[model samples]
Target: MKLRAPISTAVAISFGLLVLLGIFIPDLADFRNRILNWAMLLAALALLLGLFNLAQVHWQRVRGREATVYSAALLVTMAITFAVTLLQGSDSANAEWIFNYVVVPIETSLMAVLAISLTLAAARVFQQRTELMNMVFIVTLLLLLVGAGPLFGVELPYFTRVINPYINNVLALGAMRGLLIGVALGTITTGVRILIGADRPYGA
Candidate 1:
């Protein structure tokens, strides 16, 4: 046997135990809630790690005199954002305004670009494959877009008549139900694996 036992097993066990405790023991609910809070705290730390990594990479680029202009801009933007966040606090009016006007607009633009790229990619897939799955996907996407859009004057009969209602009520509800079921199954499986000492993700 290897000197270092796999850390994953320990992680899986802890996760499994927590999952079961959350589900079965109502009195242990507070423990589960605390665990969730800790998880979120850890997630925030991970985000900080990302910011650290970004700064490190840009600093190295600046030092090496490669793409120094872009590096400097990144550094400056990060510094300004960090300072504003720290001084005014993340929840303050100034921070909110910066996030709303600057960050939200940039994020929206990026999302739009990504959506366009995805559309092109999907179109290419349909062109290449020409399969039933691709046809179904394209049709579903078109239906979804038309149903969601505000086409006031030129109302398509099929969409306005049948598909819209079906999607809004039946499909949406069904999707949510499916998602809940999947989550439950995943939790159960994870818990079982952890209890059995078979699936440890943490180094515990």
Candidate 2:
């Protein structure tokens, strides 16, 4: 018990350094791949454990005296989906039916709700601040929404052909690339912190 934390930290630091070095050092590539494979296996196990934990929590909620119809429904749906997928295989017609009809529709509906919510939030922000950037954001958002599909069953050539394509292809693409760069930088920073033992995400 006393030596556990130190031993864990040492192992983590060594593995991190080895993996980092392996990226640039060809000699260590094989070792890096082996370590990565083990990490993947561990990650899969962790995911399975997390799923079981989720089901257990939902089961507890369903059993509680409080009105938890949603929990019960979720548990039942999850069980049925899992059983179907397992028995029929993921590529089977029944599994595909559940994924296509049930999963896709739910995801699509959530995305629609998210789009509406974001639009409303942007409107509220514009109302409050009315800054130049906020004004631009609101205008661009409106243009994107309006040009996303035909308006009043008629497609406007100017918006549909030009503005929408330019906004989506150029402006939005640039913004997404910037976001990806930011995420990459943040990940590197986090990795460095973990490597240096400043962060102990592995319960060291």
Candidate 3:
């Protein structure tokens, strides 16, 4: 069992290294493409599995009479969406109508909920501790809100055109890039640790 873990880790790391090399090394392009195709197929399978899992959970809830209304609604919606896509074809006018009217509104509602949740969290943080970081976050959020010119339909040359663009393009972009870099570095470190068998997240 101990030997199996080390061998599997080594094999996994070898493929990872190969894929990394393929990004910069021209000779490994074909190998990388093949790997990517496999990944795509796997992703598709995973998505299908997830859908099945969702359906199963909802069906159980319906059967148990636990949140039956919500479960039934979800199942019905899924059925309608699937049928529409299959029968009318995804690009058909019927599908497009459903996407635009039904799907879009639902998505927008979800986003609004998320925004409200974030706002509440921010408010709570400010209430707990009036730190410099929290103050900066509030200021940044306000700037972004003001920068959202379409919402209010009011534009000031100094604030809207000059300051908004600077905050969005320069300040926001810089922070996003820094965040991405941090994520990449963390991923690399975790990968290295796994490769070295220092971290064994998978079953033994």
Cα error, residue 196 of model 2, in Å, equals 0.8
Candidate 2 per-residue lDDT over residues 1-204, each given as its tens digit: 265478888999999999999999999999999999999999999998998998989888878844489888888899999999999999999999999999999999999999899878877898899889988888998898788888889888888889999999999999999999999999999999989887887774
lDDT of 3 by residue, 1-204 (tens): 446577667767777777878999999999988888887998899998999999999999999999999999999989888899999899999889989999999999999999999989988887898889989988877777776665556565666788788987898899899999999999999988876667767665
Regions more than 4 Å wrong, model 2: 1-4, 143-180
Task: Give the C-alpha miss distance for residue 143 in model 1, angstroms.
Answer: 3.9
Stretches of candidate 3 off by over 4 Å are 1-11, 113-128, 143-155, 165-176, 195-204
lDDT of 1 by residue, 49-147 (tens): 999999999999999999999999989978988898999899988788889998999999999999999989988987898789789778877897787
Using lDDT, give the best candidate's number: 2
**What's the candidate order when arranged by decreasing TM-score?**
2, 3, 1
Q: List the lowest-lDDT window of 10 residues for candidate 3.
A: 150-159
Best by TM-score: 2
TM-score of each: 0.72, 0.80, 0.75
